[model samples]
Target: MGEQKVKTLAGDELKAIKEAGSGKKKSRKTTSGQIYISSSYNNTIITITDDKGNVLTWGSSGMVGFRGSKKSTPFAAQRTMEEMLKAMKGIGITEVDIFIKGIGTGRESAVRALNGSGIKVRMIQDRTPIPHGGVRKKKPRRV
Candidate 1:
């Protein structure tokens, strides 16, 4: 084998690719959307999306530089929500239906933060999954 062949696109294809990749994403006018709060034992993540599930923005305690157990604390969650709300506001999100999906210590606090942000809360739904006694119990420890 000597030289390898290089692949190239036509001028129109190249121009289309450049136009598609060069511009920043277009922001739409969204007045109401959905908020997903995922609070876990180690962290809290808040994601805001349009009604159609297109994520507008998100923030986490870890994103705010919280480390270790601090990332799971209510204060951390509140702060994370505050950061997320700032982004949401710029997107014109003034009303939301919250769907929380965890039982971490920060769960409620994060909602409170959003409520205090003056955005109308259309609904709060807990999407946490509950066990229906499916897993077998472990053997009891003996002395």
Candidate 2:
């Protein structure tokens, strides 16, 4: 009763492990003016809300087939926006306040695609805030 067996993850066993961990109960309700857009190091997410700012619909780069390598591409973001817009159209949203949060190519392309699809963006703000630095340090002598 000394040595314990080690588990290995590869191929289908790995896939099964991954799939088993996916999904959670959607704990929030979708309502009808809130549009939240964000892009992280891994994914891009767009959420639409009802008049009360409750999420009415939402989409992600993953949901639009922009998985893994596709997440950083402009085409991925464009597709994400298009699909998100289509979902929004079904719920009767005409205008939105775009909240962009990343420096990726998706930022601009996604907004342009939304416009081309007839969703008027009321305002565009660079939500990426720059933190303040105190001062520059003096350079040391080269040795």
Residue pair clashes in candidate 2:
31-55, 32-49, 32-50, 32-51, 33-50
Residue 16 alpha-carbon offset, candidate 2, angstroms: 41
lDDT of 1 at 76: 99
Q: Which digits, one per residue and each the tens of the lDDT, describe model 1 over residues 30-79? A: 99999999999999999999999998888899999899989999999999
Estimated TM-score for each candidate: 0.84, 0.66
Clashing pairs in 1: none
Off by over 4 Å in 2: 1-32, 134-142
Candidate 1 — which residues are off by over 4 angstroms? 1-17, 140-143
**True-structure lDDT of candidate 2:** 0.75
